[model samples]
Target: MTKSVGALTVRTDPTLKEVVVDGKDMSVYVFAKDTKPGVSSCDGECATQWPPVPAADAEAAKGLNQELLGSITRADGTAQLTLAGKPLYYFAKDTMPGDVKGQGVNDTWYASAPDGWKAGVKRQALGVLDHPKLGKILQDKNGRTLYLFTKDEPWR
Candidate 1:
């Protein structure tokens, strides 16, 4: 259970950079399977491992848009906090405030960005290269290849 009502804030994670976290600094997450707003698919054993963040008394911290803060009723009839309509959660393994043990888990879980997007996964705005044998490939600004996995879905 949540100890007390807290504000949602952004923090710079070592790997994720800017990610949303509870006031206590515990990292929050968004499940890719949760495709609809005001809804959550994580329950039972899933809820046990990734607990839903309670919606009660949640507010956006400084620099975060309050308008994006919202809540959704879970299947269990409890209010879960949301960011831009995506449900927020806390990984059970994340004992410390900054722990992000759930990031990229099964390629379905990701730390939520401030705008309710996936954090840590940076998409290069430009830089595509053509290889003599490989044809065209995406690359980062620094010319590093951006390998996209076939199973990865776009996070909108």
Candidate 2:
């Protein structure tokens, strides 16, 4: 599989660990238009702005699940690599290795997490909130409101 994205590597951002190209800080992304896992819809001009991650027959970096790595033929007849059924890509505007300028674009694209997921959308616990009467309230790490429970101890 000679992939332009090179060997996929997992890099940890200060706040979150994510998957990146072998030597670039630019995170991989998946397009919402993709019909299914291992499929891609970003072609032509769309591909120009969001370059698909190339697939290589070579193995992924150590510690990465090989089963998660696969390739799919694009409309252009070239094989693009996919992670967990999602075609990977890089944002064209991202000029530097560490740039994630394409994290969220048009609400349709998102950075790829190390676990082959949309990076920033995953739920994370920020910290424990002390409630004088209710005890602790769990909150999203990103400051989003997360419903914990009701007075009857039922999950909200």
Give stretches of model 1 more than 4 Å off: 124-156
Expressed as tens digits, the lDDT of each residue in 1-156 for candidate 1 is 555548888898887788888889998999999976467989899999999999898999865678778788888788898876788888999999889999999999999877666789875576654343355667664345688688877893
Q: Model 2 off-target regions past 4 Å? A: 1-3, 124-156
Q: Give TM per candidate.
A: 0.76, 0.69
- The Cα RMSD of model 1 versus the native structure comes to 11.4
**Local distance difference test scores for all models:** 0.81, 0.67
What C-alpha lDDT, on a 0 to 100 scale, does residue 112 get in candidate 2?
A: 77
* TM-score, structure 2 vs. true: 0.69
Error of 1 at 95 (Å): 0.4
